[model samples]
Target: MTDPDTAATDAHLLETLANLRWNRFHTIVVLLFGLGWALDAFEVTLIGNVLGALRQHFHLGSNAMSFILAAWFAGLMLGASGFGILSDRYGRRRVFLASLVLYGVATLATAFAPDLAALMVLRLIAGIGVGAEYAAINAAIAELVPSRSRGRASAIVLNFWPVGSFVAALLAWLVLSALPADLGWRVVFALGGAIALSAAWFRRHLPESPRWLIEAGRREDARVIIGRIAAGLTDATTLAPAPVVQRVRREVNGLRVLLRHYPGRLALGAVLDFAEASGYYGLFAFLPIVVLPALHLPPARLPLFYLAGSVGALIGGFAAASLLDRIGRGVTVAGFYLATALALIGFAAITGMGAGAIMLGFALVNLLATGSWIAAYPMFAELFPTSLRATGIGASVAVGRIGAALSPFLVGYVGARSMPAALVMLAGFWALGAVAVLVWRRRGGIEARGLALEQLAVEPARYV
Candidate 1:
């Protein structure tokens, strides 16, 4: 009961898409997609780096500051879910640009806060914009890039988070070293917003995903975009027009669809995200407040540690990007997770040791732990079907945001009791993520390496 041309028409378009050689458009997608995530990292790193200064200026204790950080995470959860649904339903372009402006203005406003409460309010709003980036950017990148280099491309893009952190640390150190304590931290925040505002120009040139258009049943629009893309594959490209399959595709509406289809993937995504947030927000975020003070390091000196860790992060990101496509995702994710656990456990064992030993341990944690991010975002983005990709990613990020939101408070409680205990607990979070990936892979999770999204999602299993 099928047209013989069905396989050559809609399915053929995906083949041409997957086979297209790298082009300028692909590079543009990578940089722009990565920027959304980087801004989030820049803001987070700036706040974490400057927390010590904020506490002192506001006359606030550890717990009070923890609650303020929690406010930011709460906003991230709200925005990830809210904008994800909006982007998935309405379109990615509108939400992506709009959130940038919103977060930019909010982050800029944060520098002028009259009091701690005012800063908290602004941070919450800025967080929503950052949160929106996770789903919109990931979904778009997954669909836009060629299938052959998809894993490496996604890894490279998501790894921008570390680059943002590095830049933030450098900026923080420079500002704090030169300016007075009160003015220095404020300037760091203002700069983050200014950088985000500039990204609107590059993002404007990005094209919508053809797969999403086809999935949405916009046949002519999909063909037009695909025609332009196919023609520009190279000077000698002779790609043909994609067949117009007129079958009515049933589109599901709501988060419930994810549960019905990819319950395991959805669950695993939430666990990885939640666990990553717990460790990052709990240990790394709290380190400046707790460990740095113990080491007799000033706030300005925090970037030195961040700088050292970022070296490992850059190394890790590059390694993950190279190794992910070669070694299977299962091996990469598990290997990185296991390495991170060991780093944390090692850090916990030598807690009262000299600052040098502590710093080395933290550096290893950043190298291995942050490196795993290369695989994490891509894994989640690739696992779900095209129709549900944004919502699925959004849901997972929302769950992770819950863990991220709670992590600050939890860090205060545990760190107050014993820093050693906190490190050990944070290690447990990474261990759990490793376990989740292994378990999910065993449950027949599909790897998207060098595979077109249309065949994997839009067609039947035999065709795939």
Candidate 2:
């Protein structure tokens, strides 16, 4: 147990860190971290764009392709769960760098895979790297940014995802238009890996989270980092001197702690994550197998559709960033969840329309889906205390990946029979998320908007 005096000191440090104004340092942190996240998006979009080429080269059917997608999601589940624990117990910066390097190297190697089995294994490894980033990056950003702007900051970082998607779409179009399918796909993966590796080098400059440091009983180290953050601020306020305390290390299982103490938050996060993941992944899966054939568009033109939808994603992400701090987390998140569900239904309804109508529907659905996740990521990070934040985020993502993993297969199975049915199934997932958020709010769950992490860290019962 923590000593009362030491706890007080820790509280003061946290308050000081949380109250700092946004600065160049914070901007740099967001950009670097956001770039890593964008790489995940780039990878996903790249694979989606190249699915036709992959299928032709490997002699695979729609079900086999879905299995490959499932393999990647399975790796994500394992990586998020395992790395979340490691980040909490060890440090965020190291894990952040390590995950990036692993992703970069694995993805680069994927370009050279000789057969179906090799490609599946490489994709799985790359998925593990990207999955680790999901936990570590979200937790680090939540702790590093000021509480007042945490929502917007996280949304802005998420905004980079669509940007990456846009770039991937554009690149896929350019490369595939100029080169052979087999060669173009390899080049895209290689470029993505090279970009990821370059970003990792720059991320070496990011500092460790002071909150995590203090939680680990490294008070002096936290103080030094905090001092550096405040050094160049024009309006910097002085914080209390660090209290001399021995390092008190506790050997506790983060997962067990979360299950025992914060079951509701865990369930809520998982539900929201599941809703967004299924909708998002299902859309990509449906596009290649269902939408392309329905529109009578060639495989090469699929990237153009993604390119168009990415514009909607950017707009939706920015809109979410603006509303999150103004409307509050509960309202913003639940509203987006409900809106996305409605949009998905509309998308399915418009499937019989011309290619122009389908394109418009695709953009609108991407917009709403982007909004849902932009608001949800920060909420997941804020739901738990510093000690278990990454673990909580990772566990939620792991559970969500179950939905993500199955979504493609669901689309392939149901979509083969009925496209509308598959889409409605995805819409149901979003509706479930909306209901879960409403239930949490009615039960007196924490609002979390503009509240310091320390303030939000109280027992769920206390909020009630």
Which structure among the candidates has the greatest TM-score?
Answer: 2
Supply candidate 1's per-residue lDDT for 284: 68
On lDDT, the leading prediction is 2
Score every model by TM-score.
0.91, 0.95
lDDT of 2 at 436: 88
How would you encode candidate 1's per-residue C-alpha lDDT over 1-464 as one tens digit per residue?
44667535667666666777878667767877788678878987888888877877897777788878888998889988888876666556667788888888899999899999899999999989888888888888887778888889989988888898889889998999999889998998888888888876667666566776666555456566666666543111222332223212233355776676667778888998888888777766657657765676777777777877877788888888887788867788888887888789888888888777777777788888887767787877787777677788888999998988888777777877888888888889889999998887776667767677764564322211
Clashing pairs in 2: none
For model 1, what is the alpha-carbon lDDT of residue 391? 81
TM-score, cand. 1 vs. native: 0.91
- Mark the regions of model 2 whose C-alpha exceeds 4 Å error after superposition: 232-252, 462-464
